[model samples]
Target: MSNSAYRWMVAVPAFVVVAAFGVYLGTTHGAPTALDRSVMDTVTGLRTPTLTSVIKDVTVIFSPVAVTIWTALLAAVLVWRDRSLVRALPVVATVAAAGIVGEAIKLAVSRPRPPAIDQLGAVEATYSYPSGHVMGTTALVAAAVSVCAASVGARVAAGCLAAATVVVCAATRLYLGAHWVTDVLAAICVGVGVALVVPVVLAAVIGRLAPHLPAWVGVPAANAGSKA
Candidate 1:
């Protein structure tokens, strides 16, 4: 099979594995147990007062805004201006698709949040299996790393920053009692699955289309900075 076909094949299996694992976790551990609660609490407790306060206050801050602005800018620069859309589109599209998939999985799973903490205000709705925040952020970071991979030093820096951000975001969710550990893990799987599939698919499309685009449009966009 061709590379594009191979990517699609891999995506199908990876998505299935993530979805199945999410289902198992949701069904077997629908509710957070005492142990789950204790672990979350311990992690929350370990945060310094300043850090905890910042996390509590800014847990959801800038995520939606950052994703929106970055995606738009990247798409416009790569697609419309530089014709490198093939390089940039996958990252934006992957992050957006992952957000949608994460929400869908949460709806299907319908797991509840931890019952032991008052760190975060209660969420009235059901379906808390996979955290949208974690999944979405992971997708964004992965995309950032891919887009900046031309430079080895930049790639290394991006990777470190991305890893740190994911850790902090996941920890913040648990610290604020917004999601369970299993939920975060499921999000990670879903995010990874999406990250792996998007670029290869887009690269294949780009290979076919790049030859026809304007010369000026094929230039690579400058790396402004890491978004993670």
Candidate 2:
């Protein structure tokens, strides 16, 4: 299928799920659902000093500051590898968009974090719905997968690795009682959505405008000349 068609297929369902989940969380901000309580209970129950230490160590890697630093490095490497801003732009844009979208939704929803008594790890300062950690990491993983995977088999392998990373990221929040189940799940949806959709849209815009823009901006000189 065409890139446009594939993007549309992915974007529609992703945003829909994010919107629906956000609305649900917004409307029911008071208490955890049965499922939420059950999951939180199970996860928190498994918490121990060693386990918590390991999880916290892992979780810290996806913290906002860490994500920012690593994402910048990734973008730099991509630009260096491709020798073009065009390739790295999508990864940077997608990750940035994911962060902005995640924060916006959290403020709009204003969902509360899991109860303090339930928190077994580091308490968070932000609202809980649509976990930033999950969203950010998921976006990073998705961006990496999109750029690095070259073949169908490679894509599948990269996709599986990405999925595992996202799940682990989400689990950290749950294990810490920083967010409810819906928060991470919604984040995964939104993260993937933003990661996939932003690139496709950006690519199309860049494609159409590249020829007219300066070579340093996004269009390579030879590529621009070829188009001309």
Candidate 3:
């Protein structure tokens, strides 16, 4: 199948699952499932000061201020790599858009952040049906790997590293009782879906217009022209 088709396929199913998961969590916010409580017990049970501190740091990487700083840093890297703001928009957009979607889900669900009795870390003001930290990390890492990596091998390596980051971010949320297990799971799905869909859609649109558009509008051309 064509790459664009494959991306659309992944995007649609992934978003559907995320949506359904959100609805489930939203409708059931008042009631906790056996699995949910069990997992919470297990994660909360295993928490320690050292691990908690480490996970808190990991979770902070996706916090508003941290994400902003990280986005700026990533943009700088992309600019250094491709030297074109036009070419970097979709990559940056992937992360930003995922964050927006995650926030929207939180608003829509209005699920309370984990109760303090369950929390090892400070309870955030934001709702917690889907973990934005996981979403942002997933999108940020995927966006970076997709847009910044120079070769198949490099992309593969980046993907592995990004996946590890996502896992750590998600685990930290669970460890701190900041989110339910499925919240992190859905974030993973949404983040990955958005990351894949954004680049493919952007590339397809740009490739079609590459001939008619200004000389500075092509990603691959920009990529070829600049690398650091």
Candidate 4:
């Protein structure tokens, strides 16, 4: 099999494993238990005045606005370096696809958020099988990493940043009582699966368009320094 074929083969099994694991967790842990309550309370307790205020501010501040800003920044870098538009296309497309997929999965699962009547009061009525915040940030970070993967340092930094982003986003979701731990985990799996596929697809597109573009166009190193 070719490299692309190998990638797809790996991705398919990986996605299946993630989905199956998510289903297993969802079914086996249908409802929040005392342990869940204890854990949630612990997280909540750690939400000191400063931390709580920061979380609230950061969560609200980093909404779609931050996404847009980052996206534009990435695009600007590509455009500034006169890279092929094809190379930058995937960044936007993957993020959008992830959002849509996240919503669809949430609807299909139809898992309700943790009961508001319990310790952490509910805030929204949407299905919570997968967390949108986690999915969104995951997609963004993944796209950024893909665009910067040509260099060893870039790859390492991207991996670290992506991991940290996922953790922080997942923690924020749970602390805010917007989702159950299981839901966030499911979202991470789903987001990761999508993130893995998107860059490969974009790479193929860029490869095909490479001949038609200038020598500098689509050079991965050229855009490596740009924030994703």
- The 0-to-1 C-alpha lDDT of every candidate, in the order given, reads 0.69, 0.79, 0.76, 0.68
* Model 4 weakest lDDT span, ten residues long: 219-228
Model 1: how far residue 16 lies from native, Å: 4.8
Give all candidate RMSDs, comma-separated.
4.9, 4.2, 2.9, 4.3
Top TM-score hit: 2
The residue-by-residue lDDT of candidate 1 on 18-60, one tens digit each, is 6786667666768675666777868766767777679866666
lDDT digits (tens) for residues 37-131 of candidate 4: 67677776776667766776666533555766777787777666544554466677677778888787766556677767422333677777677
What tens-digit string does per-residue lDDT give for candidate 2 at 26-55?
677636778888898888779889988898
Tell me the tens digit of each residue's lDDT in model 3 across 32-56: 5677788998887788899888877
What stretches of model 4 exceed 4 Å from their correct place? Answer: 1-6, 21-30, 33-38, 61-65, 117-122, 203-228
> Which parts of model 3 are misplaced by more than 4 Å?
204-214, 217-228
Model 4: lDDT to the true structure: 0.68
Best by lDDT: 2
List the candidate numbers ranked by TM-score, top first.
Answer: 2, 3, 4, 1
Clashing pairs in 4: none
Task: Identify the runs in model 1 with alpha carbons over 4 angstroms from their true place.
Answer: 1-17, 33-35, 47-50, 74-84, 116-118, 122-126, 206-228
Work out how many backbone clashes candidate 3 has.
Answer: 0
TM value for model 2: 0.90
